[model samples]
Target: MLRWFLAVIGYLFFRFPGAIAGFVLGSLLDNMMGGKTRTFKTSFGPSPTVSPADFELHLLSLASLVIKADGSVSQSELDYVRQYFVQAYGKDRANETFRVFNEVIKKREISAQNICNLLRQRTRYESRLQILHFLFSIASADGRVSEPEVNEIRRMAGYLGVYSQDFESIKAMFFKNPDSAYQILEIDRNATDAQVKDAYRTMAKKYHPDKLQHLDEAHRKGGEEKFKKVQEAYDQIKKERGI
Candidate 1:
């Protein structure tokens, strides 16, 4: 399905060469997915089995893509990725992964669309949201999220099938515009107090840490932080509305 879809899209855009490229990417996806019957059990539920090594490599590729999106790579951003892996996977494993990432993954030309497509197929929606949040955190490691980085992440959100509202909500967390609280709650500023409360409840459920039990410890920590952000957004809304 992915191959055919990409092939048609490639044909439409770049004709023969585009079609060939799309087909090649499609084949890569096929190999990554392997057998359809494969499954892995997790706390949240069962998901398609994507080997941990492969998943890590693709994830690192995505990280590298984001780090380089704004023309210059920030040491802070690179350090953030390293520290995150160290915290999540422990020192030895993090170092090993970083070795491969630096020597192999970071040097490659990655297709963000291809990586996102694989993740969209293999991972849950909530997991993808966490991934986006992590990417934003990386982008903001140097204390500012550049426009180019935001744009790249937004394109990733589209490929990952994350809703626009959800994307904006995550973006708001890192950007802090006037309507940020409302954006985090996924409601409009004009929403009534009751509507705001309802949105909070919905977002709370969406970002609840329990939903990410299937993920690794690092991601679970991320989910908990996201849940806290939702609560904080709600609190801010309530204070403004005197609710």
Candidate 2:
């Protein structure tokens, strides 16, 4: 049915090329809606791809779930999300995206776990880490992250198959402390100075924006912020220990 509909649309527009494009897209849509785990492809290539816009939309949808996790959305959280949209997309696109976000929040039936699973299947590990980082930021936007929000995020992380240590590292970014710095670097307090430096370098490499350069600009920026936090943690440890 979708193929036929798009075929008509294709015919109405660019003729045969349009029909080919329509068939490809229609098949992608069918696979998505029919619970088939197939890679998305276009007529031109075999490489699977998810558009940046679609990735952003899923991130926003999961964010909405996190925002509503505690049964209420704080003003600060809403403002933070709005700011994110404005910064990532232009004001005009932000307005449109916010409308979609609002609708996502309104539909309470969608499970956060389901969204995370979909993301895990479609996105890379770095991209999933970036999404988790964004969710943590939203949770911390209200000055404090509530217990419910933490639990919800942890559950989502599990659904995404993120390691517990990675989750802790991302969590440490929003909530700062002496211990959190160690967590961010994924190091132990008793580790030698050289070990700490090694940990920092490893983490810096792991979360570097360059690693996520293939992603859209917004996601790359998110990775950069996490990378900066990792660097800051290392610097703080170095300062305290005179390393």
Say which candidate scores most in TM-score. Answer: 1
lDDT of 1 by residue, 108-142 (tens): 66799999988888888888999999999999999
22-110: candidate 2 lDDT, tens digit per residue: 98888788776664233433223444455555666777787877899999989899888878878887789888777766686677666
* Model 1 stretches astray by more than 4 angstroms: 1-47
Candidate 2 residue pairs in backbone clash: none
| Highest-lDDT candidate | 1
How close to the true structure is residue 180 of candidate 1, measured as C-alpha lDDT? 93
Against the reference, the lDDT scores of all candidates come to: 0.87, 0.81
Residue 55 in model 1: lDDT: 71
> Local error of candidate 2 at 100, Å?
3.6
TM-score of every candidate relative to the true structure: 0.80, 0.76
